[model samples]
Target: MTSDAPAAADKRPRKADGDRLSKLARHKHIISQLTAAPTLRASELAAVLGVSGETIRRDLMELQEQKLINRTYGGASRPFALEPALTDRKAIMIAEREAMAAVIADLILPNEVLMLGAGATTFHIARRLASRAHDITVITHDYAIAAALAVNPSIRVLCCPGRYHPNEGYVFGTQTIANINSYEANRAIVSATGISARGANDADDEAGAIYGAMAKRAAEAILVADHSKFDQRALTVFAHWTDIDRLVTDRQPEGALATALRAAGTEIIVAQL
Candidate 1:
């Protein structure tokens, strides 16, 4: 005896199922956004996802628990990952760094005293300066920079004394800061892990301290960062945009970052690579 039934009407879609699917979709969208940018504010994400801030917070908590992202103050950031070592970084963006180095080299005058920071881009700048016939005195905490300029008889390299960080190929500590303060330079050329409206940032605390001291003692402070660094946040904010005299980068900064740099009165130099 077959009874024609509609299989219980396909068991009407469950409310919980729809809610779970929606939450899953939201998680995916959040991950995609974070993958594109290093960090995103909770409020921004909430608006984009058309959800309440509270909902976003809960989602962030779950994502953090899953080791998908890191929860920051009022925001979420990509999961913590160690920055690449200097040797690896040296090859990452050669063309852009070279162009930036050339621009920076043009700014230096013969016999001017310079303070150079430790990083791949700064290393390139040191190389460019070394190639010039100009006689300059350079005070630096980077072993690579010192070595790069060593062959140039026209350039005098003064190495800052401190504890050496192997991966960074540089020296940093209290001694480094003290050494930086001992002499005031005409210009300080530095690099950063990130730059945003908040400030110029670094991944290492000790290195940040050295950079800060150098910027303070120098007559002019120049920051060399790439377009990739714009709007990014690092572990330590070493200098604000107002503290920098010039910002030399591979591309022009856009959006809030550009506005903030302008408001801070930092001269922006876009290197034509």
Candidate 2:
């Protein structure tokens, strides 16, 4: 009697058996797209990948479960919680931040008082200022920024007295706000976690309050944010577009965000990287 077992070749793994591997690849592609653009609609993703809507939805679910993306109403976006620590942020968008910092540095004229906010991008601006040999006064709440600029004898670094946040390496409190109110600066260069039609937002309340105080005390408030910050929303709206005189970014704003920025009369300077 002949055995009923199938042939060895027929029992071997086939292309259909690689569904798990294919799904993993698809998941990575979805994450990459989300990283490039803060938000991505499911329909657009499905069409672009030539996959069914149901498959896209399933992939999004898996990605969300893995904490690689945040599921929104009709799409997905990068997770928005607290802003990353300064050191962690220093490694992100380095090229864009450097270009933006250079642009901001050029905007600074010698002898003008400047207020710098606490953020990785602003820290880059502080480093840029360190390279300058001009005499200027700098007031900031970020300890890292103050330390970075301390090497410049021509620049005076003033630290705001407040409760220190060790994790962020910054000081922010009622005292910090009052200190910012006591002095006026020619320009305030600030960065935020997100920038949308709503406003320039921060992930922390204290930091957001400090940004508002700084912007309020400056003659001109310029916001420095990279392309990744667009279309994203954070916990706190620190300053409205009306409060900002200019925005220096790596890329041009698009859609509603672009329209809002134009309507607000905020001069947009796209840094050449």
* Each prediction's number of clashing residue pairs: 0, 0
lDDT of 2 by residue, 62-121 (tens): 888887889998889977645777788999899999999999888889899999999999
lDDT of 1 by residue, 123-171 (tens): 9998899897378999999998999998799898999999999878899
What TM-score fits each model?
A: 0.80, 0.76
lDDT of 2 at 151: 90
Best by TM-score: 1
Identify the runs in model 1 with alpha carbons over 4 angstroms from their true place: 1-68, 72-82
Q: Give the TM-score of candidate 2.
A: 0.76
Give me candidate 1's TM-score against the actual structure.
0.80
Instruction: RMSD for all candidates, in order, please.
Output: 8.3, 9.1
What global local distance difference test value does model 2 have?
A: 0.88
